[model samples]
Target: MGEENNQTVVTEFIILGFPSLKKLYPLLFLLFLLIYVFTITGNIIIFTTVLTNYKLQIPMFYFLNHLSAMEIWYTSVIVPKMLSSFVSENKSISFSSCMVQLYLFSSLGASECYLLTAMAYDRYLAICQPLHYSSKMTNLTSHQLASGSWVGGFLSPVLPVVLISKLLFCGPNQVNYFYCDAQPLLKLACSSTQFTETAITTLATGLIFSSFLLTVLSYIFIISTILGIPSITGRNKAFSTCAAHLIVVMIYYGTITAMYMQPMSRFSLDINKVLSLLYTVVTPMLNPIIYSLRNNEMKHSLTKFFKQIDKRKN
Candidate 1:
């Protein structure tokens, strides 16, 4: 009787992603397909370029390799499901499958946050304290930092997933969005979400806010050091190196903050979905382009890479 009673309370969720724009489905499908292909290709290229180019074997490129890897998984976590939703009439995920998606997506997202922080600190040491940079960010230290980011990122989401698993699902099983997310999953829990929400919020705050603060602080010091340069050319050159990092940081953090920090009531559900898409899909697609376009080293490496390929072909 008790189990039956609990089952009656909740069943599933209705995911209303991109709300019934029947006309837009075809266009949206093609657009997202292209975006996914580009995102995968771009990140793979960056990862390969960094690995093969002897010049890019430094700490920064090491971090870039991990970031590219994260981007690959991160974009994969949401985009494929989203694209499928556009074409398929039935948008449904099994309870177990939803949990898996949630776990992997949140894990990758948290990992990227810490990875970005590590990258920022790498830049800080390189730019602001070039004298001690080599010793401070030694190969061993870089390996440790990179390993920590991956481990920490994986651990951060485990608690929430465990907590979520304890909840019962009774009736409404439809998740309104293309993929599983914490917010949507929370809404479907038959049990009270007070404890789960509080726990997830605390973890997110610690992971996102702390990493963001550290990155911001590192850049502040970095900007100050760049400003201290006496020569205009020197300052310009210095700022250019950091500019790509800053731009990507702003776009990523800005969208994330906008999406997660706001009260649910303020925005429509569709708006929330769009914002989520921006951060999860659009940003990953843009990272390599933003980083490579402004980076002379990456461009040079890419050119040399293509030339080498051409020589081998001939």
Candidate 2:
């Protein structure tokens, strides 16, 4: 449906991003601006390093490469707009722009869920089914899993966006949050949002929790297998491979569950914004660090990558 129709009077929305911190706009802007740059730069480094370094061309790094690229797109979707709200007074977003933002944000979030699951499963095979790791996680298989993740994630948000777009918003155009989130938009709907809310919640639960369940199950097996290893060094090595990913999963799901899994309308708007920041801003920056810091191979690759760059300049 078109944004402007007889039933819907409000064609745009004012995103009241962190209104409680309005007095500290300059500090917040500078802070998140630095974060945005770091997030983009860090993920780019990971992506480029994984792609070029021959020794890092394995299934784990392959997935990490895709994840780094996604993080770039993911942060690009929301952070720039957030910075705008911090710097400029014009916090208004057109209806179409809002929907597009919501769609992209949700799609990338969903893709990450599936991508993380794929990574977990890859770790599972590497540790638990070592005999079959190579055959099971072939290049083609990795390609399929990663492509499926992106496809499924992008498709998951289509119905919700379409339904929300059709909702009537007669009076309030003020979205009391950082982004064009479904819950906040629903709160401002002129029409009854019972069905829309139910639909979005149901889809989110299935999408988010199911991926969580799969990832957990894979890790459970991986942990059990690690414990069964006869040598302490072997167990440590096995655990190290997946430890960073496990921490990342916990933080990602923890924040997402807190924000989107419940009735967010009942929560304080500031709390909601904080929860949003954990995943949208903080997690992306931390991911590459977690992976590179924990994985010796990744660190070696990164060091080699920089040395090569310096050599080229010299």
Candidate 3:
């Protein structure tokens, strides 16, 4: 059935990115440029802060350093090209380039989910199993956990992305959005996509579900232990550390849950585009602010570091 539909394979695709706002493209470009600047600078600050401060050499901050590093690549996967599209009359992306974007976007997104789970587990150990936390999350173990997230993230999408990219696209050459997402790519394929669709679905489901479940379970244990504290100060202190993590988890997972958890037939392109913006753009920009500003250690470190720079200048 699929072979019959093949006529001519498309070599490149034109992206109709945010076509609804044609008149406002310049303004949107400025907005995106500003966002990219802040996202890059803020995440870099967190990454550098963690590296420079010996006091932050613990597992929690170690994982955070990796998260900031991941955010840099995560948003970079889409934002740079999307930013280019706003100004360039030609928004066409070669088929290979589109697949690369798809792969990186998916890989980094998966890595973040697992990284969040890792952070939640760290909090669980710190709050629920304080004594064992030190021995359990040793420096080597911290490196291993951080490495595992990156490895899992990059590897998870390889097979699916490769398989999907190889699918014949003797169809329309215009993708109605900025990036080449899996579902949109599959829709463009001239071949039967049931198998590819099933594979992508299974991989995505396993990745999102497993990480989300672990994060939820870890938080349950953390909250239970926090409530068990005898004094208000003790409870507040315990909750305070986890509060930032929880806020981040909510923002990250909330958007993803809305985007991915929808039934396949019910996926509205417009809605997905909006939700994608939330996770891919907004969340990356907000991470450093949420994690750094809310935590006492980060505030103190950044304040002192800036003061030192000022003194040196004088």
For each candidate, the alpha-carbon lDDT, in order, equals 0.84, 0.92, 0.88
**Which residue ranges in model 3 land beyond 4 Å of their true spot?**
1-6
TM-score of each: 0.93, 0.96, 0.96
lDDT of each residue in 1-314, candidate 3, tens digit only: 65565588799988888999989999999999999999999999889888999998989999999999999999999999999999999899999999889999999998999899989999999999999999998999888888899999999999889888879888698898889887667767887888888787777878888999999999999988988999999998899888888999999989887766654446878888898899999999999999877798988987887888799999
Which tens-of-lDDT digit does each residue in 61-105 have in candidate 2?
999999998999999999999899988889999999999999999
* Candidates sorted by lDDT, best first: 2, 3, 1
TM-score, model 2 to reference: 0.96
Q: 231, model 1: CA deviation in Å?
A: 0.6
In model 3, the worst 10-residue window by lDDT is 259-268
Residue 139 displacement (Å), model 1: 1.0
Give the better candidate number (2 or 3) by lDDT. 2
lDDT of 1 by residue, 1-314 (tens): 67767556443345456767868999999999999999999999999999999999999889989999999999998888788878887776666777788899888888888888998999999999999999999999999889999999888899999888777766576666667777777776777888888788777877788999999999999999998999999998888887888888898888777666544335665676888888888999999998899888999998888899899999
Which residue pairs overlap in candidate 2's backbone? none
Q: Candidate 1 regions off by >4 Å?
A: 1-16, 262-266, 312-314
